[model samples]
Target: MKRLILVTLTLICAAFTLHAQDTTQQIVPGRVNSASNQTRPYVIMISIDGFRYDYAEKYHAENLLRLSGAGVRALAMQPAFPSLTFPNHYSIITGLYPAHHGLVDNTFYDRKRKETYRVGDTVTVPDGSWYGGTPLWVLAEKQKMVSASYFWVGSEAAIQNIRPTYYFKYHEKTSNDQRIQQVVNWLKMPEETRPHLITFYFPEVDHAGHSFGPESEQVRAAVLQVDSAIGKMADAVSKLNLPVSFVIVSDHGMTNVDTQHTLSLPDTSIVKALKVAPGGEKVLLYGNNEEEISTAYKFLKQNENHYTAYLKQETPVRWHYGQEDIYNRIGDIILVAEPGYAFSFSKRAMHVGHHGFDNNLTDMNAIFMAWGPAFKENTRIATFENVNVYPLVARILGLDITQPIDGKLEVLESILK
Candidate 1:
């Protein structure tokens, strides 16, 4: 009887070992069989702040080269305006335009709350009121698939009472290498509970680009540092033998604006004349009443050196910059600077780069690259939009988020196996 019991225990141990191995080897269903027909595979979407298309093509970075050379690259990703970080990033995750998402700008007065919402604040959490629409992470959770985020707008919000299984508090001190490691570790979790969708954000490059021009040495160095970190992440993914897809994207590109290109709205006498506050770049003229609104519009129109004025409803239909509900989000009059000219209200001398230009300008066109089993290799797709990202992400995790979305699930035909 003793011998039989020992033998039984040994057999059970063998079965358990086999089960563990099988779990580790699990891969999502779907293979890149055809260029025309491809489905979502497990996805890891990385957003490198202020990453421009030219930076990848011209800067000669190895990790970017691997992603572009091995995977599919979009020529440019045009971000939704005011071309600020929060609004565009929110659009990317929700697959909705900023007008629909309600994060219209990086900093805007929320009339309902009678307060200002800034992207840098961590106090806003798990509040569906502040974060409109369903973010990709929240959608992933409903389907019982795990998701994780290092730093992404609304990731900490705890929307719909759902949170990524693993999340870190927002921290400026977090190193790029550390953030990458966190993502890799999450991916390395046991298969049954491992995050199917992971989002990693790198902001140092963007910060450097804003402080220095996109082509400045500081920005280039930051880019290289981010590139090396990305290489480490790619290596980690490879080592794990995990079948993962990667979508590398940016919110907006950056451009140089010297004093020659500077336009001060307050100096133009627009704000004082109208008795209202001047909105920053991509000029917004805010006032309390119709009389003030009319005055702001007249002031903008009179000053031809700095801006091209438009009524909130009449701002260019093609840019999709205007929506009925978005009236409160925008200023009374919209001011778009002429090419190379940046709008500012400060009198302390103008400096640095800006991205709130028309989308046609290359400076406003961001970067996008994707790789792995779900993508078609070495092919470029021009019809891509930032809003299209969420649908592809949703399909990867098998999340049934049936909410209406602006982005369509057009198969990325370039990165297929």
Candidate 2:
């Protein structure tokens, strides 16, 4: 009994230490804005995770509505296919489809590396080697323009051997006020050192949507909470007299799935012959070889009910997955659930809200709003792909795109002043 208690205490202390590390700020030394870059405009890119395209209006997020109305708003922003959190957020920043960026899913198995990259895993989440593409911060730092991140996907990793000059490991314990003040403090730094590009993220809406479903009062409350915080942050930043632009976006939108009847694998006979990675809206199955994969694929298609089975090479072209997979991370077979259904093995109740669906669905669209000095007044635009945001931010901060990316600048160029 004493030994068990001691072990339990040790595990608790270890977990607490990890969380503490997440809260502390991480600053890379020996980086500063160049003399030329010091005069460049500033942009604060904010991502509200799982904020649906219509959330601001549906929930009456007055502050967001007001701010977006004054500058630029999109009818909606289309997330890349497999509209999951990590993939789409990375897609927004890198201007690459998930397959192009190599973060093809929130959790994907890389056959080449013989490893699985799962979100929220302490070891893999911060490992730079798993990531590809030059993130905005990496681009800025390469050009002697400093950048910072309050919280954003890939911000914690040192992609291309560079992390933002100022960043924090993600931890949800920090209050809204503290996060806002931290941004204000960073902006007030000397011009030579202040980050010209800042990335901020909010996870409240996503949390609420998952726990209580998109239509619940809890989601409304979360939307209001984020709206209130943004209003405060923008009001405080405006007082600084700096030319700042605010681009609000979400990684993906939420949908309420049919919870009463969750979708399960149609065939269990071949389970022993395959490896499986299960996501809420999709499942990936890997087989030992072509014959094994073919057999499993045939079996799944015959027994298909709520889900559709596709061989990896035959996934929708728009998803940029399957044959476009550069890292060979996609499984041999993928099972995508129908919109109203979710894939699960547990008999227990599934989460009512879910994403990770086909991005072309209207319900999967996310929000996009740009305001402040960088945007035209009272401008509203049509739906645009989220990938284009990378070039838009690059244009605002005067950074050049160093490599080939899927996003084209012309798609969103009209919104700028």
Candidate 3:
């Protein structure tokens, strides 16, 4: 009887082992949890640098207009303060204000490294230490979802020590077609290696806006060119019958720069001791000593018509700038040029267009539109800030976002199906 009992126990253990194997085989590849009943969805986020909110409306971009009607489109996307490329792009991905992300300016001094980080500088752009907050790609990769980036401001770096499964270093000269094809190739990867999240960047629109004014014919051509690329990608996705959510956005808009209306300070003792970094409509001033600070402040105040000056402590709460000064990177004084005005230290050269103005100005607004399996059709949403984009991405992918980000998922809730 004892031998019989032993044999029975062994048979029961074998049956339990087979049941567990069956359960494991039923688990979906992309879905980490079965509770959501969601297959991992594909998300492609594209950034058109310096593309203004009104470009599609003004240029008659059929593709963009179609996307707006087919999915959800914001009237405008209010960029964070400084309204520059690097900061706003990073803000959209991280769902944090530029102040919170620690990229307060496109060009900033790193006191810790004693080096200045500037755009187009290969060494600085790829260093992960300069970036703060976890971006969407980094967050997705943490959850075991594959990710890729064609080209993004900080994608080349391993932010928070996490890099996407696939990413390419940014090269401005890469043709738009080549870039789009690469993204298509990544999406075509076998299910075992496919990227669930991807980002693509295009600087042509911004380039055209800056070189020729936003209203110029060149800008219109650039807008249409990018529209064509979008149409092609959408077609490819449809052909594959792949479930994809495509998000298109821009960093900031460009406005006409008044070549005749320039603000130049005289070479006083105040000016000599002051270090001025001018970003078209915005400027940052640092001083060598208390005397320099006093002199520069008084000079700027005496001529307040050209620009408004603010101390680091007195920066407007709405601007959302100069948070905590943990890096001591924010300058002692901040200057914002009045609309239709430009700032210069010595000689002022005329640029066709410029940004980096107050965020409240309509001219500084960017573009936002999304279409895919998860969004509502024929949805037109009111304008929202770009910071909220991060949470939307997290929600679409069914990922857990545990970080302290400022984005609110409810802001875009109406657009979700």
Best lDDT goes to which candidate? 2
Pairs with steric clashes in candidate 2: none
lDDT of 3 by residue, 1-417 (tens): 000001111111111111111111011234332322236888999998888999999998889889867999999999998888888989999999888888887766655675666665556677898999999988887777778887677887779877777776555555777767777887777776777888987777887777678899999999999999998888777776788999999988889877776775555666656655546677677777777777788887776867898877788888778655556777778888877787654343556677888988898899999999989998888999999999998898878997898789999877888
Candidate 2 residues 1-417, lDDT tens each? 000001111111111123234588899998989999999999999999999999999999999999999999999999998888888889999999988898887777888887877776677778889888889999999999999999888888889889999999878788999999999999999999999999999988887887788999999999999999999999999999999999999988889999888887754667557877777788878888899889889989998888999999999887889989888888789999889898875555677888888888888999999998989999989998999999999999999999999999999999898
lDDT, candidates in the order shown = 0.67, 0.86, 0.76
Q: For each candidate, what TM-score against the reference?
A: 0.83, 0.95, 0.88
* Candidate 1 structure quality by residue, lDDT tens digits, 1-417: 000001111111111111111112122232112221122246888998888877876677788888767778878887876666777889999988877778765555555575555443434333556777889877876655667777677776667766677765555555666667777777665565567778888877777776677879988898888898888888888787777888899988888776555666545443554422233456555556777678767766876675688877887776676644453665567778765677555554454666667767778788888888777777777735788878876765556767987787764422344
lDDT of residue 233 for candidate 3: 82
Per-residue lDDT of 380 in model 3? 89
Candidate numbers, best TM-score first, in rank order: 2, 3, 1
| Residue 108 in model 2: lDDT | 76
**C-alpha-based local distance difference test score of model 2:** 0.86
Q: 1 or 2: which has the higher lDDT? A: 2
Off by over 4 Å in 1: 1-41, 122-127, 266-280, 324-327, 347-349, 411-417
Cα deviation in Å at residue 351, candidate 3?
1.5
- Work out how many backbone clashes candidate 3 has: 0
